[model samples]
Target: MTIQSAFAGIMEAIRPLYDAREASNIAHLVMEHVTGLGKLDRIIHKDGDLPPAQEALYQQALQSLLELRPVQHITGKSWFYGMELTVSEQVLIPRPETEELVEWILLDHPTQPAWRLLDIGTGSGCIPIALKKQWPAADIWAMDVSTSALAVATRNAGIQHTPVRFVHQDVLSPDASKVLPSLNIIVSNPPYIRESERTGMQQQVQAFEPGIALFVPDNDPLLFYRRIAALAKEKLEPGGKLYFEINEALGQEVVALLVKEGFEDVRLKQDMFGKDRMVRCTKKEAAPADTTSPS
Candidate 1:
């Protein structure tokens, strides 16, 4: 069958399950993954024929799409901060808002020699890998509680040739300090979504994505933030920065929490859609004491 005919057939098959626009997107994503043909290229090669093997592959991809599986899972890859990273059900798919957090960090701090960074709950190692790629001289460390997730992250780090120290440790545990030293920057896109909120999420997310990496108990929505912030205060050097990809619904509460924790100049920034999606703040510098008090 011609490439165009196969593409049309796949889209039509999934049309009942998704809106027209979403069906088109899924069709394009599947085609790109299976045939190495982008949307425009597919149109350009509409009349070109597909071999039987390629056609079979396309059909399988379409079947997955019809089940509403995420395109990244189907392709086994995801693009984040200009790098293609491997992904699986074990790790949370990197989101664009997290890229905003990375941008805020890079913009606030000038790259310097010997700068050390810590990424808590480093799902796919997106933030640390992006930082290492952008500032090769900076020292990077990533920690995660899930060994399966760490395996995927480590593989992506190697593929990207971005050197990072990956440690399998639970950040929520009380003795996190034992795992690493103080850092110049601490960043996380920790689990902030409450369990009750899960009902409102898409099927692709609620059904397929790992729950531990995406949720916090409704009663303690700020659990990870509190633990991470306390650890940052102890481990971060004076004047070091903290960054987070936050839930917009709890922006005010999160900002207040950080400020009360002695973070100075705490600020919430909006994403492309004008939602409060990122936060940045610095550890307060110590005040110098008077030296000539004795007479």
Candidate 2:
């Protein structure tokens, strides 16, 4: 089949699962991955015949797409914060909002002489790895509950040469905070979606992505946030920062939780789409000791 034919075929097959623009985007992603052709190049070479091997790969990808698989899963990779990271059902595919969170961190600490950072529930290790790339001098660590997710994250760190420390520990467990050194920054894009929200999500996400990395109890949607914040209170250095990529609907609740937890300078920011998705707050500095000899 020609390039145009394969692209059109993939788009047609996935249209039932995605809208016109999204279908086209998925097709473009698959075509580029299989053929290594840019969109304009694909257009220019639309009639060019696909190599037999390329055609076979295209067929496999198209089948996966029709089965409601995410394109990143089909490609076994995702781009986040300008770096390509391996992804699978074992981990949540890193999202663009998380990249914005990373950018916010970078903007806030550009001149820090050293950073001791930890990313809780670091599924794909995207946040810590990207931060390490920019802050090579930083001491970076990542933690996740799943061994499989940690393995994927480890491989991405190796492939990207970011040198992130990965810990296998459940953030909910009391001991989760015990293994970490005092940190200058703590960040997480934890499982914030309530179980009830599952039905509202796209089929590819609900069907193919790992549930352990995407959900919290409906009664406790801020489960991860609360736990992570508690841990940060113990593990963060004085004046350290905590960041979260939050569920848009629970922005106010998260802010309130952080503030009540004694965090200061709490700020909830929207992503490019204007959803209240990212938050940052500073750990309160310790009060100074009294110096007067007589009171």
Candidate 3:
């Protein structure tokens, strides 16, 4: 079949799930991946016949798309901060909002000669990998509980050529302190979606992505945030920063928890959609001892 015919098949297969324009876009991206063609080449050669192998690959991708699997998963890779990172069902696909979190950290500490950063529940290791790229001199560490997820993240770190210390430990466990380390900055984009919200999410996400990387109990939506914040209270250096990519609904609750933990300069910020998706705070400076107390 011609390239146009393959694209038509993709569009027809996806029409029920995606809008017309979006279906066309997905078809084009799949074609680009299969044929290794640039946008202009695809447009210019729309009438050209697709090789049998290329057509077969496109058909397989179309089937996966029809089942609501994410394109990133079908492609086995994703782009974050201009770096191509490998991904699997074991890891949550890196989202654009997380890029904003990385950018915020970089923007805030551009001139620091060096600093230490810890990324909790770092699924694909995107946060630390991206940060290491921006702050080459800084020490970076990432922790995640899923061994499968860490495997993908480790491969991505090598691919990006960014050295990040990847630790295997559950950040929520009662005995998790042994894996913890004090740092100048702590950032996390942990599982914040409530189980109640699962029904409302896209089937592509609900079915294909790792549940542990995406959800928390509705009754305790701040599960990860509270634990990470409490850990930060113990591990963050004085005047260090804590950042989170939060569920928009729990922005204020997260800020309140940080304040309760004695974080200073707490801020709740919105993403491009104006939803409160990010919260950041500074560790309060240590109080000085009174001179009169000297013996």
Give TM-scores for every candidate, taking all chains together and pairing residue i with residue i: 0.94, 0.95, 0.95
Candidate 1: pairs in clash:
none
Which pairs in model 3 have colliding backbones? none
**Candidate 1 vs candidate 3: which has greater lDDT?**
1
The lDDT of each candidate is 0.89, 0.91, 0.89
Among all candidates shown, the one with the greatest TM-score: 3
Error of 2 at 63 (Å): 1.5
Task: Write model 2 residue lDDT over 1-295, tens digit each, in one string.
Answer: 9999998898778887778998888899999999998999999999999999999999899888878889999889899988989999999988888889999999997784477999998998899899999998999999999999999999999999889989999989988888899999999999989998899998888998899988889998988899999999999999999999999999999999999999999999999999999999999999999998995
Tens digits of per-residue lDDT for model 3 on 214-281? 99998999999989888888889999999999999898899999899889899998988888989999
Q: What is the lDDT of residue 44 in candidate 2?
A: 98
Q: Kindly provide the TM-score of model 1 when superposed on the true structure, using C-alpha atoms.
A: 0.94
Winner of 2 and 3 under TM-score = 3
- For 1-295, candidate 1 gives per-residue lDDT tens digits of 8878887987789878788997887777788887887888989988998878888888788778777788899999999999999999999999988888888888876644469899999999999999999889988999999999999999999999999999999998888869788798999999999999999999999888999999999899999999999999999999998998888899988999999999998999999889999888899987788888789
Task: State candidate 3's TM-score.
Answer: 0.95
Worst 10 residues of 2 by lDDT: 106-115
Error of 3 at 248 (Å): 0.8
Residue 173 error for model 3, in Å? 1.5
Model 2 RMSD vs true structure? 1.6
Once fitted onto the true fold, the runs of candidate 1 whose alpha carbons sit more than 4 angstroms away are: 16-22, 38-41
